[model samples]
Target: MRFSASEGLRTMLTAALVVLLLRWGPQQLVELSRVWGEWSAPQQATAVTYVLVVYVLLRSGRGVQRRVSWHLSAPSATALRAGSALASAAMPSAGGSLSLERRARHEAAHVVGFLASGVVVEEVDVRVRPDGSEGRVVAVDNKGLAPVEQAWGYLVGAVAGNVQDLRDGVHDGGSAVDMNTAQSQVWRVISCGVRPAGYDGPLTADALFEGARARAGEVLEQHRSAHEAVAARLVEYAESDSRVPLSGKDFDDLGVGRVPADV
Candidate 1:
């Protein structure tokens, strides 16, 4: 919601221009009509064609600019592929026997984070696989969020899981995928030219990841009760059927206040 001085000045100038146009627009339009009437049929056609071509070129240029900006900001294909491969490779194996309860808490934390940030979480699921327990929280891609908020959303799952693990005096090993995913998202945010608050270091994924991790931890700690309530509910669902995911409505029915208390 904040704007630089230059932006404020530009907005003021634009408003003034709009007011002037509104005052003089009728007279200008009448003058334009007079000139148009004086033009021959061929001259009118040529002018219309010229205006159309200029409009088309301007629109095409804007579209190309938008596309280039998006490409520059978005994560590269190689980074995405590497993140996926790393997530799969770093998954806990069957030998470790990851508990269903832990997986439930992990996914529940994600749901809490998304809901707190005004993102729409569709479902959360904890599955018991032969290799190990795994969980996922499916959320709508809310592109309207600020970059810092999006980074917090991405990092909160791992931060909350780690906090829980520390509380229980257990070694945490299930958040590799979460961290990997968060790092990639942080990289994308940095590429988009936004830096995390208090970050003055080189523009690297690691720096932003740490900043985002700390902020997510702070926010999750502030809403610890909500997270705990969600986690308990997820555990109850897993007890009945670990495969059945909890819908957004199910979480809403719990009556726990979202982290921000408002969307």
Candidate 2:
């Protein structure tokens, strides 16, 4: 009860401070906005030009941000994603290397899945679906895309990334993802026949999903190695002054025509 009372007192004091600041802040801001009205004509022109320049710069910044994340993944999507990440932060065990950031862990895990299942990750980017849902889309730069963009292979990687126990095959789907639930979600996507543009139907969907799942399980064994590689590459990319081209077919190499796969 004492603790609650103290907390209440603190909250009231903070609220009082906010009220006081609000009471004192408006007049100064009002004066600042009016000072511009008294400027000489040349000074007014300069001020207007400055405002326009600032506006242009803001627009340019938005454009650059849009280039990375727009329709598929809005820049604002991070607001949603970061909130979840913060709410679900989990510290590692005593022996587990704590150096890996959550992003590094997720990127490493997903990258291994990408390599094993052949998801083609040269230009993977976040995007929003027409259904108003957010997800990622990876583009293959031909060099990285497997000859056969098997829907099952990609699906298996995704499922494995979602459900696999990264810790020691004994985890309960840490804050990152839930293994059992992840598997179920993957199955639902397949059963619903809602394949993405490239991974559409052949009848091999069911069989391939199972095969991919099994293959992904094997790939999980190399999670540590994969995680390490991901961390290294992430640092390498950060230091390098380069960008991955977003061109090329989503399911095939540049010169190589659409390589056929069995769904």
Candidate 3:
């Protein structure tokens, strides 16, 4: 019920990866152009535009996350690792504002889920679990984390494909096809869980060769940590807002006494 800290880190890492790929891919493409001189000026322009859009969206999202952290108390500094305002680059712009609107809704849902998860936005109580994990709502809200995180993943993967197309020459051999496949693969990994929808969890030559399930599982693991970090930060936010002394009986009530209070 709490946000997964690992998911936050995964989001940040994914954004960073996308930014790096978006920036570097174009540079590589441009350098390749010098040698190949195959792509026309229009093609070059389009490639550059795609790369720029991805990087810009990621950066913008990071900025917005920072700003909101400064102003709000629920999401917390976890934005540095697990937030999604900038992932909007992945959405379709031509579909009017529907995509953007969905992103907004998801963002709100994320914040609300954190609050609803017992963050106390004001207080805390704690009970230690027999398993040694503290019983508390100090975690960030990661409920439905898959949708938002996967959406961003899809965007990054798509940008990677677009870049690859430019590098390989979209018209050359199977360049465009490869790109499409990679993009689709990325989406499937994100959307279809550790396997594609209706995949029946059975391993086959194609699945093994594709490594789709393995890759998706890896992503999910990464996301798990980011979500936890985010959830912890949300607890910190609650502590800060409540102005409660984190070392007292009330702290136990708010679920902070049993855990290390490292906001």
How many clashing residue pairs appear in each of the predictions shown? 0, 6, 36
Candidate 2, residues 43-80: lDDT per residue as tens digits?
54544565555556667998988886654342111110
Q: Which stretches of candidate 2 lie over 4 Å from their true place?
A: 1-105, 122-150, 162-172, 175-185, 188-213, 220-227, 235-263
Q: For candidate 3, lDDT tens digit of each residue in 1-263?
A: 23356644444454454456546767655554453365445444544565566778878999999888665433211211112212322332333332222222222222222332222222222222222211111222233444433332332222322232222233222223323433443443444345433233343435432443333233323333432443354345343444332322222332221111111
lDDT of 1 by residue, 1-263 (tens): 45466654544453344334445667665555665686556555555565555556667998999999886565432211111122233344443556666666666666666666555666676655566555667665447666554554555443555555545554545455656666666666666576544455566767666665555566566767777788788777766765566766677764433344221
Model 3 scores worst on lDDT over the 10 consecutive residues at: 254-263
Q: Please give the ranking of all candidate structures by TM-score, highest first, separated by commas.
A: 1, 2, 3
Candidate No. with top TM-score? 1
C-alpha TM-score for every candidate = 0.54, 0.34, 0.18
**What value of lDDT does candidate 3 attain over all alpha carbons?**
0.34
Candidate 1 Cα outliers beyond 4 Å, as residue runs: 1-96, 130-132, 157-159, 196-203, 242-244, 253-263
Better of 1 and 3 by TM-score: 1
Provide the lDDT at 146 for model 1.
63
